[model samples]
Target chain A: SAVISQKPSRDICQRGTSLTIQCQVDSQVTMMFWYRQQPGQSLTLIATANQGSEATYESGFVIDKFPISRPNLTFSTLTVSNMSPEDSSIYLCSVTGGSEAFFGQGTRLTVV
Target chain B: AQSVSQHNHHVILSEAASLELGCNYSYGGTVNLFWYVQYPGQHLQLLLKYFSGDPLVKGIKGFEAEFIKSKFSFNLRKPSVQWSDTAEYFCAVKPGGSYIPTFGRGTSLIVHP
Candidate 1:
């Protein structure tokens, strides 16, 4: 399993402020996934990040709102641009290792 | 497109009670099933998975799930419950050969001692 370190674990930001969450993996992985869990809702895939390429965003997500950067195989970042209260949710970074997917301790974002 | 469904939104049980949570998926092809648990203040952890072979698979913490291919269901079960077992459970399915996994609305389990 890959050990994924994500931060900041919890944060409070103004509605118009942007916040960037970083994910670092202990081992190199081919792909990294970003997911969002809204309060009282299920996990939804935000995008799939691959090294050396642009991220593929999901239907309701966009690059301008949720920009992603995958500089290498072991590190990636997700930036919530122009925050809103609806953007407040738990963001998780995951990597597939072997047959299982390992997750990081999610970043809990709160936009005031 | 693939989607997962978990029948129960919330379940409450007494310690030592039997437990079962229903999960279903909609996909046209073969899939890999997974059950993940999130304890309070903890990250999601894999409880079990079913890729192929046996339809019945056991996972960590005395948890198990059965995959019924014909029914498109993978229901999680535990013979008995413990207070420490309280957590939220999610069922995810990835179509065979696909990199994306679709997750179900989680089921919140509350086990009272």
Candidate 2:
């Protein structure tokens, strides 16, 4: 399993503000996945990032609302742009180890 | 593309009772199945997994699951429950030759002592 460190562990931001969450891995990985777990909802994939390439956003997500930057193999960032209360959720970072996935500690964000 | 379904959204169990959490996936090709548990405030951990060969596989902490290919189900089971078993369990499926997994909506289990 990979050791992933994500921050801010939690934050309460005002509406229309942006928050950047960082995910650092212990070792180099080819791809990193970003997920959002809304209140009482399943984990939804926000985007998939591969080093040096553009991040692939999911069906309902876009580069404007959720822009991702993957500068290297072990690091990536997801920034929530112009957030609203509806954006309140626990955002998670995950990487595949062997055939299974390992997750980060997660960032709990609250937009008010 | 693959998707997973967890029928029970929330489950309440008493200590020493048997447990079963249903997990079914939609895919016609080969797949890898897994069960993950998230204790309150803890990271999601792999409970068990099935790749091939054995249809039933055991995982850490007395958790087991059986994969029925025909039904496209991999249900989790435990002979007895403990208070410590109270957590959110998620069933995931990764199509063969792919690393990305599709996660179920998770079943939140509450075990009273």
**Candidate 2 regions with alpha-carbon error over 4 angstroms:** none
**Candidates 1 onward: DockQ, in order:** 0.78, 0.77
lDDT of 2 by residue, B8-103 (tens): 999999999999999999999999999999999888889999999999999999999999999999999999999999999999999999878999
lDDT of 1 by residue, A11-101 (tens): 9999999999999999999899999999878899999999999999999999999999999999999999999999989999999976688
The B-chain TM-score of model 1 reads 0.98
Error of 1 at A104 (Å): 0.6
Native contacts present in each candidate (fraction) = 0.68, 0.58
Q: What is the C-alpha local distance difference test score of each model?
A: 0.95, 0.95
